[model samples]
Target: MGSTASDEDYFQRGNLFWFTVITLSFGYYTWVVFWPQSIPYQSLGPLGPFTQYLVDHHHTFLHSGYWIAWLIHVGESLYAMVLCKSKGITDSRAQLLWFLQTFLFGIASLSILMAYRPKRQKRT
Candidate 1:
C-alpha cells in the first residue's frame, strides 16, 4: 500500500505532541488529585469542571492521583482530536470545539515543553 497524507511524514513530531500532552496532563492530573498543590485550584477555581468531576466521581477519586489522572485523561482525549486535525491527519470538518481544543492543547503542549527544557551552557 502507498502512503496516505494522514500516514504523515511528521509522525515523530506529532508523537512528540502526544507524548508531551500525555505527560503533562497525566502528571498534572496525578498531582491535582493527590497533591492539590501540584496546580493550585485557585487558578482554575475549585468550582471548575475538573474539580466538579473529582467531586462527582468521589468513589474512584478517593485517591488524588486517580481523580486527577482522569481529569487529565478527558482533557487529553479532546486534545488528541485536534492534534490530529492540525497535523493534517484529518480534516477538522468545521467542528469549532474540536478545532479549538486541538489548537489550545497543541499550543499549550509546545509552550510547556519549551518552558521545561533544560538550558545548556557552552563548554568553551
Candidate 2:
C-alpha cells in the first residue's frame, strides 16, 4: 500500500510571502511599541507621516492598537484549533503547531485550514 500526500501527518505550510510579511509586521509593531524613541520615525519613508503622528500625539492609541492586534490573533488561533478538530487533525503535535502558527501568523495559517479537504476512506 502507498501513502499519498494526504496520508502524511502534517499541516499545510501556507503562503510564504504572507508569512514573511506578517512576521515582519509583528516585529515592527513590537519595535514601535517598545522603543518608540529609538526608531527613526521621520526616516521611515512613506510610513513616516502616519507613524510619526501615532508616536508623537497618539501613543496611547498606538498601544491600544498593538494589544488589539494580538487579541485578534489569539481569537484566530482559538478558531484554528476548532477548525483542526473539525477537520480530524486530532494529533496533539499537529494541533499545537496549528495553534501556535495561527497565533503568530493569523490568517496565513487559518486560510490553509479553511481550504483543506480531508480524504475519507470508504467502509465495506
Candidate 3:
C-alpha cells in the first residue's frame, strides 16, 4: 500500500522541524562567531572575547567540540551523496548540489531531500 495523506503530512512536519533546527544552528553559530558582543549577556558568557575565547579554549573540550562539528559536517556530506544514490537520483549536478548543501546546511538540506525524493515504485 502507498503512503496516505496523513503520512505525507507527518513527513512534511518532521522535515520542517529539521529545517528549522539547521537554520537556527547556523544562525546561532554565525552570531557567536561574528557578533558575540551583541549577544546581550549580563556578564561575559561562557566564552569571553572571540579571539581570547579561541585561545583559552584551545586544547580543551570546547576545542574538541569544534572538531567534532567539523567531522559531523563531513559525515553529513557523505550521507547526502549516499542518500541520493540510494534513492536512484541519477543527475550528477543534483547529487553534487545536495552533497554540498548538506555539508554546509546539514538538516536544512535533509528537508529539501525529503521534499524532493522520488516516490517508491509499488510492487505488483
* Best candidate (score: TM-score): 2
Give the Å error, residue 103, model 2. Answer: 0.6
Cα distance off (Å), candidate 1, residue 117: 34
Mind giving the per-residue lDDT tens digits that candidate 1 earns over 1-124?
A: 1123332222222346666776676566556555654444556765456764674567354475565645664665566554544444333342343334434444444333223212232122
Weakest 10 consecutive residues, lDDT, candidate 1? 113-122
- Measured against the true structure, the TM-scores of the candidates, in listed sequence, are 0.32, 0.85, 0.52
> Predicted candidate 2: what Cα RMSD to the true structure?
3.6
What digit string (tens of lDDT, one per residue) describes model 2 on residues 12-122?
776789999998988988888889888887688989778777788988888999999999999999998878777767667778888998999998899887777768522
Ranking by lDDT: 2, 3, 1
Best by lDDT: 2
User: Clashing residue pairs in candidate 2, if any?
Assistant: none
Clashes of 2: 0
Which of the predicted structures, 1 or 3, would earn the higher TM-score when compared with the native? 3
TM-score for candidate 3, residues paired by index = 0.52
Where is model 3 more than 4 Å wrong at Cα? 1-59, 114-116, 120-124
lDDT scores of the candidates, listed in order: 0.46, 0.79, 0.58
